[model samples]
Target chain A: MSGAVLLSLAGCALALLGGLFASSPLSARRYRAAAALAAALIVGGVWWVADPRGDFGHPITAEAVDANGAPVSTVLVLQRDGGRRQVRRLPLRRPVDGAEYALWAALLLGLLGGGLQYRTRDVGPRWLAPALPAAGAGAAAVMFARMGGLESGEAGVRAWLARFEVGAVQSFTVPDLPWSAQPEGTVALGVAAAVAALALASALWTTPRSGGERLIPIGAALAAAAVIWRMIEVGGLPWRPAEGALWAVAGLLAVAGLERSSALRASTLVGAALALAAVALGA
Target chain B: MPRLPRMRGPWATAWAVVASPWTPWALGLWVAAGAALGLVSEPGQHPASGLVLQLPAALLVFALVARDLGASTARLRWAALYAAGLATALVGGWLAGGEAGMAEVGGARPTESYTRTIAGRSAAAHLGAQLGATLSADGAALTLAMKEHHVGEAVLPLDGVREAHIGRWALHLVDVAPGDEPAYARLKLTPRGGGDPIERAVRTGSGAALEDGTQIAVLRLSPDFGRALGPAAQIQVDWEGGSATAWHFVDSPDLDARVGAAPWAIELVEVATEPRLVLGVRRDGPIGVALAGFGVMIAALLGLVFAGRREGRS
Candidate 1:
């Protein structure tokens, strides 16, 4: 639901559409148009996610009341406000449903592979093309999974996430808020299952003849599998930007290299530049 | 036309120089230096300053990348990739580190952070009026800093206050008493930049006493709020105790303790140096220690990735 996620998905979709329509110049043009659309979606998503709206609320002061106008227990939500330090409370949403995430992730991978087929001159066979998209989507999903709902119910997740810690990254374990608890817990499990199912289905359905045909889709599927496993292994975890950047760079590199034509080459350049620019805005 | 390998022109030589593998090494060195400087610089100043530094670092990295990749690919691809990397680093850093100077205050410790809100105005109120000081591990020593000095009578509530030691020139602590007990414990410390208003306030033993010089006050808590200052003159006390303990250091030693009721069992002792106020809560809990440790790591990693990618790709 974040802009980065959406942009990444749109990128994959654009790439896939480009692949599907590779046979004709007209189709390639249409696919290129789709790529542009995907880029826009990504930018919009990034802008929205990095919203700077400030929410100011009254500070919580711990007050204890006795049985009859007497003090029983005292708690002070010591609010420290300085011109320098500003703390905001970001109520964590539930871990998105794992099933839904997997489904989307799979779709994204397929789209990425498809896009590569259209752009690349000889991407082997029809079946092999989905691999690139699979890789992109899988990698992105795995990375995305690392972040879902870690902030749910926690007061200081944002602050903590902003800074670096050693060892096991400790997320803020909040006294579970009512709204986020059930959905977060259930969605994670469901999404995990759904992704597993999607991966399995894609694996069974797609078949290609030559090694070149298998290369793109197989690589993509493998990437997706890696992502799925990472998500599950990390307990629906998220990746820090440092680590996540690797995937982004890799995705950019893979797509850029898949084609040699002036148009595909230009599209890759534009896409990569846009992605980088998007990264710079820190949206 | 001889067509001797395109005559091995100067263009090829220029391209080789520009896109040479050594570009990564040169870029790597610059990126490393920039990151090291950014981390080592004084906290709270680094975010903006570091950002400024990043431009040069990104450019260098991109330059090396463009040189190497552009020759193989078209001029446009080279330019595009370089631009992308630069943009990504900037956006990523901003998104992660916001403007509030959190990244500047980079290290984490298991201590509560405190800020004083001064209500009144005094001479120390103008430019160079603010003091930004930090305490050492002992919670007894301090790094005193003066900023934009101005004078004013300020109603400063020192949150996360644990203890205090006032210099003679500025302020002095009169007494610290437990909410449940009245016996006043006197903090002992040497006075600097001498003045007598603090001694007079201590001698009168009146909570209403106000010192003429800088006012400094230190507070104590019993893991709970037994007694604390309320709005205006009201003293709020909780029979059930549970407040985090720490101290606040002020410039003036004179404090208006009459804001609260008197406790019964407290002792007064005079020592050589004024007890320095421990500014933040001493938590040292798991989360605190972990966060500080990780903060440094994450920052370093971000620098490495941005620097490394451009070089590696090129």
Candidate 2:
């Protein structure tokens, strides 16, 4: 079987087992625990397997040639193969939107925060219940709107494969971003950072101290902020505050619901509602 | 002092009603039913756009009502809600669209003058052009032979067809190529009465039976098109001179989707063509949304598991 089919099968199986165990009585506590763990794994596994970048079905890749047996079309090109560094590009298609990457990362953080809050006896900052998701969604929207990928001018996947490159790493280089290297970009980024830091500081204030739990929300907050920064500053994305805020609303609702408590049932239900809302608005 | 029940008034009453085990299932069913309506008109189009809203609404109902359902029965009821929603959606998708797709839309129409070309000077361009052939279907594969002279015919099977058009192309009766018997077979054409066909053009990318440079057009049927046509069914082909020709078919449509629709790549090995549109499946959208949906479901299940774990612990 192809890797995707195997992954899908695994996901379906885990989901099924999880459902069954979820209803089992106290006598089957062991099975329930195992099922829950399996279900958790399914969430991550399915996401990875189904990602647009995952290229789930098509495994066959061939060069399109002309009548003279010369190559005509290609899809993907490897700019650098990693031992020290790796880079790949599709000349025709827009590079993977940085905003998309940010959105997924935010989701990861959301899941992480929810998991972390499970053991806490006391809730973290009441404000965090709303602020975190708002920030996350807003940042995502802003980043997405700014992406070069979404622009009409951006090329498709066919173009990306046109150029093929392979090279050994000579030296690692950090490409300068508009946000970091330029003054205007730096100021805007700094202001956004300050606003985020204030929100996070407030959230962390009331959080319980155990297993370094404080880092969870902070890390999540940072991830969201960083994604926004990367999109605008480095990717040279446009500014659209309203769109950003809308996504922020979605993010806020999502995180608030999921992070409210570690009680699996309640959180899941809440998470589902908020996440769906986010997708509806943003997608 | 004895503590009175910490809740009171209309708010408390609302909570009591929502806490009932059947509420989630009932609500979920309602959502599925409502969403299924959007898919009813045409399943072939895969039109599930309302899913974007319907899914959120169902989830929101659950979220709004989800409270401390401390007992086993309540948890079981919640699981039932998930099952019901899943079942309902599956049924909906199936009814609206065929199996894994959507739309009961329309039937296929005949195509005319579809061509793909490879611009190489000496590239082995293979093409298939057929006329007045009697087809025997072996589930998308056909044992086709010209009725008049038993000329160029091959068993075209699963994934062995490239571009198939249902319109006009003429048969060059005088042009004949002696093809290899086992692998490549020659076709000899004998026209009853027609001058539209150029009797010298050939497309031999893989093993087409006409001479090289014979500009020919043949009816390339859709996957299972021949099978769907039953034995000796007449197929229409518009001739180059505004005339129509009839070809016979055999068998039934292979219900298996792959048999009806082969991967486009499979046809490339057997047939080379001029530039033409190549269609393939390319799914684009946020898979993260699907993941999130599953995540929510699993998390709910985890809650049930935790409940069990806690009960066992206690």
Candidate 3:
């Protein structure tokens, strides 16, 4: 099948395995490690596939002609194919200001804080923790997906999907986006880098004798920063249906990690109810 | 503290180095090597947008070193070294020709008439027009024509269209271009059963059986006239009019998006007229911001993982 489907299946399998093996203490550590690693890889892989640097081709070119069969000039050159360059003029007359960058920044920061709180070792009944984010994220994702579905009729969805395809399959090029260019080894190299970073983290944790208390803040900051940067790069809302679903999953996992029986029971009931509600409402 | 017996030789030296809190420097060196490789590969040839991408490695290295070295003076040195590493990356990106200028190009509605012509034989031209003006053809080949230019269509002798891209948008021709049996198809654009033309036009569907050498009129309706025809709205039939039936009736919208209700609302009718096509420049906002957004998402995800693992350790 498609690489995306394959990768996603692999990730789901890993997450499942992690959850399954989490019954034993020794296996719990392995479970967490596998889950985290798999989730992280999926996240990275999706982003890479969606934004393949080398595959982003430009839209408008310099040699483009107008409707009346005249050459198109006075537009920004975005891509160059052979000798023809795709170009489009700047400063469209009317603009749609949907959401500002500042808003996105705020949302990302909030997600980071929420994630931190949910993952914090001591806060709340352990079982209640992950469910909080999971429920909230899931609710938000479902709502956003509805909106996106409505807009599926518009060209926006197709264009967005085009970016993903173009990034993956090298042959695809968006003639309208003339400036699109792909980054060569970013994917393979990025994955390798991630693995190395994970290894390094493992080494650090294993090497230390005890007392992880002091390192928590630094780790938190790194996580926050990384999440922020990644959110920015992904260029969509955290509540965007696809990526937002991942966050929801993260939330659920966080709650599950808390390990409190009543909280787990309550969360399970609430989650099941929510799933049922979704199904009923959808039907 | 009681002194333990001294461990000697290569393994001891290696352990000393590994535990020496100088691992950050080693990590930094390794990071540099990775960056070097990334530069060499330069898969997509995307010029660097900003210093965002390199932050994860820097943060990871700095946090690791700072945690291992404690809050001592040595940690301060590591911080400075981390900054140096970042600076080196920025410089490397610059050397590799990554950064490009970001010019602001505001968004515009696709409600205006737009025309794009592709020159050279076997060349395809895509013009971003109002979504309303988009039409479908159900013949062996699909051809679109500009008012002034010759009406030409792709002469592919294929029956079914595997896929299609109109301007930046992908569309399904199955809706407008009937089943495989039709020899020719015509998409009409005139408003039906006139309301005040100033108000919304009741655009009902009208079909013209297309035969060889069949000519159709492409109407360039006004914004007021176009807005009346909403999504899936089509004209019922062509209205035979008075003296104004002359060429002057065809309206070309102003390119400025603000000047009209919608910039690309000029409709394409299926009847032949002196003024057949309304051609003009169709503009949309520059895509740099969107590109930047995609970049930000990627960098953030990577950073999150790095931070998550690093924090777990600390």
> lDDT of each prediction vs. the true structure?
0.30, 0.28, 0.27
Can you write out model 3's per-residue Cα lDDT over A49-134, one digit (the tens) per residue?
A: 32324222222111223233222222122333443323222211111122122223323332332343324252444333223323
Q: Relative to the unseen true structure, what is the C-alpha lDDT of residue A68 in candidate 2, on a scale of 0 to 100?
A: 32
DockQ of 1: 0.01
| Selected candidate, larger lDDT, 2 vs 3 | 2
Writing each residue's lDDT as its tens digit, candidate 1 over A1-283 gives: 2333333333333333233233244334323333432333232323233222211121111111222322221112233333221212222222223333443444455455435544646356533543444343344335443543222223433433443332233222233222212221122222222322333333334322211211222222222233233222322122223113223322332233222333444333323423332332232
Please, what are the lDDT tens digits per residue for candidate 2 over residues B1-314? 12225578997876666654444433433342332232222211223333533354445444433433343464545444433433343333223221111101001111111222223121221122222222123312111133363333332222211212211111111111212211211122223232232222123223223332222233332212233221121222223334232332211222211222211101111111222111111111212332333334334444544544455556
Off by over 4 Å in 2: A1-50, A53-91, A97-105, A115-124, A149-267, A273-283, B1-314
What is the iRMSD in Å for candidate 2? 20.5
Worst 10 residues of 2 chain A by lDDT: A175-184
Please report how far candidate 1 places residue B102 from its true position, in Å.
5.7
| TM-score for candidate 3, residues paired by index | 0.27
* Fnat values, candidates in order: 0.00, 0.00, 0.00
Error of 3 at A137 (Å): 0.5
